[model samples]
Target chain A: MAEYPDRLKDTLADFNFVTTRSERAELLIDIAGRFEPVPARIATRPYAEEYRVPACESDAYVWSERQPDGTLKFHFAVENPQGLSAQAMAVILDETLSGAPLEQVATVSPDIVLRIFGSEISMGKGQGLMEMVRTVQRHARSTLAEQAS
Target chain B: MPDRSSETLDLAQRGYAHPDVLVSTQWVADHLNDPDVRIIESNEDPLLYASGHLPGAVEVDWAHDLNNPLRRDYLDQREFEQLMSRLGATPQTTLVFYGDKNNWWATYAFWVFQLFGHDRARIMDGGRNKWHAEGRPLTREVPQYKPTRYKALPRDDRHIRAFRDQVYQHVQVNLPLVDVRSPEEYRGERLHMPDYPNEGALRGGHIPGAVNVPWSRAVNPDGSFKSASELRRIYESEQKLSPDDEIITYCRIGERSSHTWFVLKYLLGYDRVRNYDGSWTEWGNLVNVPIER
Candidate 1:
């Protein structure tokens, strides 16, 4: 089992825009808590083999391990793993609140999408959805940068 | 205090998707057989269709779909109308577009549809990458076409475009041409569309009257769009984009511009948005066109 890192724990703690650390921990545990030990499958079409994107020598990334309750949890080494963009975090909150599938959330609508951590969240379709998460991280970093400046 | 607070409370128009935007690969697959739904693969790569694509998807190459070699970036309404005619698209067709890297071209095409006054368009979330990853069926065989009699809606010329002539006509006018490309591309450090390389590229700089708001800044890492309200707050409050200001977006070859175009026109309800389709590719190549950095 991969151990959760200390920095991630602290960052998760510091995200008081959503809730306190214990509350965040409780949310993570609740969402991913019910897992049974399932075999882990690391399935990815090698970009070099399929798509021809140049391979990096040291391309390290997060991986998920199946828990005893059959759910998958991700772990990160460089930064916070459970640290989602406010939008992504919102999708989870919406799914939890409305009992709708994650697939049902729309990323560009004016509807009152459920808020997680005081951020209204929505989902975009396809790989472009990553743009939404990046937007949040950029906002956070820009906010930090602005404050520093 | 009342005036400022009233301004805060007032929203120009709450723009959004009719049925909300995100749709899973499974949901798309389930509706793959719908007669009213047409799946378009808007890829930069030519072989996207040859390799394999959604069973009934018609191929749309961004380079080919938008322009000929003569005018690569911009598509005049007549040209755009003809392209729509060839695709058998009517004003009423509910275009469900998907692209290889999520929905870059799909979103671009969605913007094109809106420019042409077709509102019934949606992007397939996760795109073909997610669809194929989920063990969904793909076929290399091109589906036989039963061409429908689709007619073009008259171009809403006011909403569709802004030509160099128009910009030149208003050269002294202080309109903001917002370049949504990366800082490198906007500064002319990067060539437009590395695939179709061109020489005589702008040495290094941007439009004097332009602002750099990289499109990638508006997205999440998981390939979804940010919420509209947050997006509004970011672009409006943070970036200080006035609601009434006229904004034009451009990129290397106009693909990325369409992403911002979607955000501005459809997402934020900025109705005065115009895409400078010629972008750098056209503007940079013209011998007499003014060059900036």
Candidate 2:
């Protein structure tokens, strides 16, 4: 059994192999550049606040749902478009885990979060990135809890 | 009190200590075509500049650019020269810096430039936040230009930056220092700023004898610096800091402190001011450091 979502696994594989600081910087810039503007309806206060990325200094939000197919999808935005710290995490999770199955989402261990974002930022700030991934996984698990009852 | 008119005038009209350091958005809009002026956006988030920046502005990441790859310190003179050249900036070019967080990293960039002794730098007052609020233009197109043969002066930290050891000594002697983090962080209630995740600090609280003056107090809601008189009320009257005292400012990281550093050094013309970049993360993590609530 594949321990990771195919999409998340592929994206992780794509980033996991990058070995240089300069390359990591470029990859982050590439992700930051691809801002698909969230519509106002989605970015409104109550909607955004409910799923906000925890502990981010920037005003960041995320909406996650488990599809009928038992996969997870993510939507996220930060009020400060220039807040790279929050954006880097948002971009990584949205790109990797969107529509990922529960098992694969579970496979997104905190270590993997550390692995993905640790080198990109400094290890000193790795705790926040770890929590960010955990937040996403937390949202994914809620769906399982919903179905359990 | 002979000149009543002079007293009534605001700091902008009466002029700042270094009036040229702040350029207005309208001024930047007018000089959009001036080749001699280079707009640089040094945001805390590199992606912000990539999303949309002012026309012809270059992006510089404080972490990737200013910081040395293998060391804890900033880049040396040779690396700084290359960075300036790559950004299409000549020594004579007027580099205007702006970014998110009300020009916090903008002034951080300015302070780093000062560390390298680059004197031709100015900050775009109000930063990107104010610019966006005003409904100004932002473009996703990142600009490129021919590299200049840049010359970097000798690195100078003597007048501006402070290390943790100096902080310890200052604490013992009870020299003037300002703990510019939030009251909670200063009071040992939290290790990080409110709503910000903890950044790997081992312990909390601040250097003994350091006064808690939150950095946010220096700015207006729109993110511009308050008038000089109002600033005096904060630093001179409230905080009881003299203009000539050797003062050190700090926050969780160095960026927030740099904003206060700029205000003291340039806006109010304080003679001796330094930013303790080692700050809370460094202070809180280190072993055997005395901390106060």
Winning model by TM-score: 2
Off by over 4 Å in 2: A17-44, A47-50, A66-77, A81-99, A110-130, A143-149, B1-11, B140-142, B192-199
Give the Cα lDDT of each candidate. Answer: 0.53, 0.77
TM-score for all models, in order of appearance: 0.57, 0.83
Top model number, DockQ: 2
For candidate 1, lDDT tens digit of each residue in B130-245?
57666888886676556556566655646756666765554458776778877876767766323223422444456557778888666544444555665776678777786577
Task: After the best TM-score superposition of candidate 2, give how far the Cα of residue A118 lies from its true spot, in angstroms.
Answer: 6.3
- For candidate 2, write residues B174-222 as lDDT tens digits: 8989888878778888655232343447787888888888887887777
- For model 2, name the residue pairs that clash: A82-B48, A84-B45
Worst 10 residues of 1 chain A by lDDT: A51-60
B67 Cα displacement, candidate 2 (Å): 1.5
